[model samples]
Structures are given as structure tokens and as C-alpha cells.
Target: MTAAFTVRVQDEIAEKLDRIAALSDRSRANLAAQAIEDYVAREEWQLAEIQAGIDEADRGEFASANELASVVAKYVKAARQA
Candidate 1:
């Protein structure tokens, strides 16, 4: 079961939400919850990656400049091909 919570938005943001809700035929609360869920997931992923990087640094795990260039070039080539 989920519980209700209160959130406050400025007038302009509220108006935008209202318009989106009308166009999508969804409730304001539903759109807000979806937005919040996405924001939380993205932030959590970023935080985990940052922590992993810090842990790697603590163990002195790093790539050389040439190694980095090779990986970047591989992806760039693939992106251009796509």
C-alpha cells in the first residue's frame, strides 16, 4: 500500500504540470509521482557510480592516457557508424 504525502510547487511549475496532466489525461499527482520516481532512480544510479569510482581510486585502479584514448575512439567510431 502507498501513503499520501504533501508537495508544494511554485505557481508556474504547477501551471505547467496542470497543462501536461490535461494533455496526457492524467492526474497531477500521478505525473508528479512518475517524475519523482525517475529523478530518484537517475540520482541513485549516479551516486552508485560515483562511489564505485571512489572505491576504484582508493585501490589505485586507473587507466593510462593511451588506454582511455583507445576506449573513447572505439565508442566514437561505433557511434559514427550508427
Candidate 2:
């Protein structure tokens, strides 16, 4: 099953899409559909992760002080190195 729809984009974006489509040897519609698919999949994963975190919080699940400190120290060390 499939659905058809129309969307509007800025001229610059449309031009960029056209260029990408040509370079990839794909039609504009195909490229657009793929882009939409990728975006939807990424958003769905992020939403699921966020909901899981909320559920965990509701159940009082959280990292211990040492765990938090470990994460912070890891990032701080990385930042200092950068």
C-alpha cells in the first residue's frame, strides 16, 4: 500500500534536492521519499528512547552518585583532551 501527497520546499532546497537526485541517479520523488523515510525512522527512535526514560523515571530508576560522577568525569576528560 502507498499514499500520494504534495509538499512545498524553498527554491534553494529544491535545487539542492535536484542536484542530489541527479548525482545519485535517482528521481526527485524517490530521493524525497527516502529522505522522509530516514527522518521518520530517526524521529521514531528518539521518541521511543525519550518515553523509555520517562517510564524509568516514573519507576524511580536513576543512576547512583558514583555512576553520575563517572559519566561526568568521562565527558570532562574528553572535553579537556579536545
Residue 53: error of model 2 in Å? 0.3
Task: Candidate 1: list runs displaced more than 4 Å.
Answer: 69-82
Question: TM-scores, in order shown?
Answer: 0.79, 0.90
lDDT of each: 0.97, 0.98
Q: How many clashes does each candidate structure show, in the order listed? A: 0, 0
* lDDT (Cα, tens digit) per residue for candidate 1, span 1-82: 8878999989999999999999999999999999999999999999999999999999999999999999999999999999
Residues 1-82, model 2: lDDT tens digits: 9899999999999999999999999999999999999999999999999999999999999999999999999999999999
Candidate 2 lDDT score at position 6: 96
TM-score of 2: 0.90
Which pairs clash (backbone N, Cα, C closer than 3 Å) in model 2?
none
Q: Which candidate is the best by TM-score?
A: 2
Model 2 alpha-carbon miss at residue 78, Å: 3.3
